[model samples]
Target: MTHQQILDKLSSKYLVKSIDEDVARLTYYAMCFEKDHNSQFEYIFPKLMLRWNCVLNADKNTVTDHYRLITILALCIHLHKYGFADKDLTAEALKAIDKLNEAVVLSDDFFRKSEEIKKIISSLPVPLKRKPSIPENITFYREKDVVSIQLGNRFYAAYIHRLTGVNESPVIEFYNGVFDKVPTIQELEKLNAKGRVYNDGTERISHFSVSGMKFLPDLANQIKLISACVEQKPPHQHLEKSVGLYIVMDIFKLQDEIKSIFKT
Candidate 1:
């Protein structure tokens, strides 16, 4: 189920007066943890720790709202995963559980409503897996086809050059010109001949994975070969072994490098 649906069900069943934005976000993160273990480690763990620290420092009179209760339950679940062996962490978990029990006291004081809430959290469904970075249906470009590269409002140009590296992976060679708009094939050819290499005189070329290549616009009409302004050499000798090392050449890094080179 989607996180929103889970939140709605929780709100309706528990008669939660209002859903705070922080509670909603934590619920989403908790559901994400249920879906993928990697997401829990990479994204949710640090945030959960921070929330737990806040609970520790909170004043006695501070209101323990829905957000706090959700945080406590998430912490309890996380501790349960670690086998609950750390004495201090176990004490903190027990303290948080007590706070939840105190905050959730009903009229008769007989119902351990916190236990029911924990059961609901434990039963949240695992969500669908995430989609791939590059969709399967997108077409790839052939050699010498002009492609537009977008960086925020501006556009740049590059083309699918021949295979490089020991593995014979395809590489995209970027030209040294930025455009206010997407340039046509003829305009790109003119830019290519301007002999505008970087200050170090090295041509800007880098390997990209097929997934990373999806960011470049699809191939332009087949055009005549645009020869390099100078003798072309490998941009970085250390990157000769494999395309994996060049993953850092993704678009954002390229944008920063281009901006720094031109001082734009």
Candidate 2:
């Protein structure tokens, strides 16, 4: 999950909008722990410490310490929700939580002093036993590969293309034409030449990273690459430096927009 998705989920779930970067990052790690609990603390703790140290090293201030305490509180809350027992929590984790409780008692911040953070923590949803349904046998596709999605009785085609950058990622570009059956690569190529392509709201080609999708399991399964074609060099595009964390596309939301466009 991307950091923005984690922040949005945390905000909506807790009905609180005051989450800072530290809280979001710690919550993300907590979720990662829940997903890979069998990995043991030896593996997870070092990574957590590394992440924590990086943030602290980047900015050393009293405000950073305050955020760190809040993050620790949020992590402990999530860990308990995931059914971690006292024995399961490490000494450091226990100590951090104790520190958070002590800080909360003396803190003057409106959210902390009023115990709103505690209320929000207590209101977290019941934990799930499994992560989001990503197919066990996953297939990674490269540029020029054709994929399909079935919406009702009609099928839509898309082709994969890599963006030009240091951190290039595969993006799926959807065609505008609807098909009675999955179209062949040759047919999609012809359609592409005729300018039969879907453009997103920004007037850019309708594209997204498939790995970022979290919901719409049926659509996810149907969108696997169907055919591989010749690799064409991707066009050059300017990339912007992301300010905070990466934003993940919600494919379920994208599916809704597509359905509305086709009135399906």
Candidate 3:
């Protein structure tokens, strides 16, 4: 089921007649936990998983919605894997790719003398998986390939079109590197500095929260971008708007959490 379908069912079954939050919450609980023990992030997990498995289990092109859904989810998973997780998955995957033989031997680990990079990488996230090549004039159409790079890793991939010639690593590598180099949150606050993350710290969108510092809009924008790029065709207007609205709704719920956190 698409998120809209789930929401529609939710409204009909619970929202219209009763104020009980349990039904909606319980359904989510069942969808994730009661059904799948592998499901992580109790209570605070992104509900995308609920609709995702539903779509995946459906048959055929009929599951078009689910394919699009997985595309975005994969990207988000990629982001988490890259950022809060590990930076090496994409790199290792790229290394095994045949076309990438021209990879420059940039900064080879001098383990013959000093630090061992492999051990460090093993402790990080797994490598990025290679994108399967799509045949030209194909039966199964590939979405226009846009680059999904490890921004922190410094190398960026030319996603859609096969760039005939290029020299660089994925951007995620660099992005990850730069962020690691940035001052810690406490240090930034002490310096009275602002972040360039969303904007110059002035354009605060209404957003939801998880931890005390990170807000839901952070996740929302990531979802929005991933959704747009995931489709076999361009994303529909409603798809984009739906993501935005969902984000707004998250913030509404998030507001109370913030209040409780600050309460005496």
Candidate 4:
């Protein structure tokens, strides 16, 4: 079930009456935990595990809504896998576990790395904010038809579409990449898309434009971008936002691709 669907059912059964209100409350609490896991945050854990077994917030970690659900479901599944069942075990719980294990295992690992990096960054002293510098150790090299991006021990694949010989652009196709989800071009176009409410209460759409190749930079740059932001700035929520945006974009792309295939 989608996050909202799960939220709807849970809210109905629990007599919460309003999913929006519940989501807002849950999101606020989740944000607090993401910034710092403390006893005050402990109360929500039991309720989640015992009642919902899910997080309904769209941007719990600043990623897409689906991932917010998956992130919660992964933990729920892990708990169940270790022989800890919730108060009420339903088929939905099993389905969630199976879907995550079968479909998004790699994506789960990717988020796990992001979490590890966040912890490492939080423990380190504040790094001096020098001019944004790309690490020299990182390299992107093409061998045969494949371009490999290497940073430390991690490697990602980059694709250069030159066969058409017209307006060749480098992209990392979602299916060909390490990520289980990728955003569509349409989704990327909405990077800066936000509604601004004016003093008079009128709203206007504003957006930031992100380049295709910019998002497909070498793996090192992606890591550095998040890590540097964390090291230079305390309260590393930016790290989650950055990684979340990439994940959101990839997922949109993947969805669009699947839709097109079904159409044909």
Best by lDDT: 2
Say which prediction, candidate 2 or candidate 3, comes out ahead on lDDT: 2
Error of 2 at 66 (Å): 54
lDDT of each: 0.40, 0.42, 0.24, 0.29
Error of 2 at 201 (Å): 9.7
Runs of candidate 3 with Cα error greater than 4 angstroms are: 1-46, 64-76, 79-248, 251-264
By TM-score, how accurate is candidate 4?
A: 0.19
In candidate 4, position 59 carries an lDDT of 31
After superposing candidate 1, which stretches have Cα over 4 Å from the reference? 3-139, 163-170, 193-211, 215-248
Taking the tens digit of each residue's C-alpha lDDT, what string does model 3 give over 1-264? 222322232223322111112123323333444433223223323333332233334346444532333233232333233222223433432332212223321222221211222233234444223322211111111223222211121211111211111311111100111122222322222221111123232322122211111111122111111221322322122211121211212312333322332221
Question: What TM-score would candidate 2 get against the native?
Answer: 0.35
Off by over 4 Å in 2: 1-139, 163-169, 193-204, 212-221, 231-248, 260-263
**Candidate 2 global CA lDDT score:** 0.42
Clash totals, every prediction: 0, 0, 31, 10
Instruction: For residues 202-230, write the lDDT of model 2, one tens digit per residue.
Output: 23334555432221122113444557774
Q: Please give each candidate's TM-score.
A: 0.33, 0.35, 0.19, 0.19
**Residue 72: error of model 2 in Å?**
39
Please tell me which model should have the higher TM-score, number 1 or number 3. 1
Backbone clashes in model 2: 0
Q: Output the worst ten-in-a-row residue range by lDDT, candidate 4.
A: 224-233
* Candidate closer to the true structure by TM-score (higher is better), 1 or 2: 2
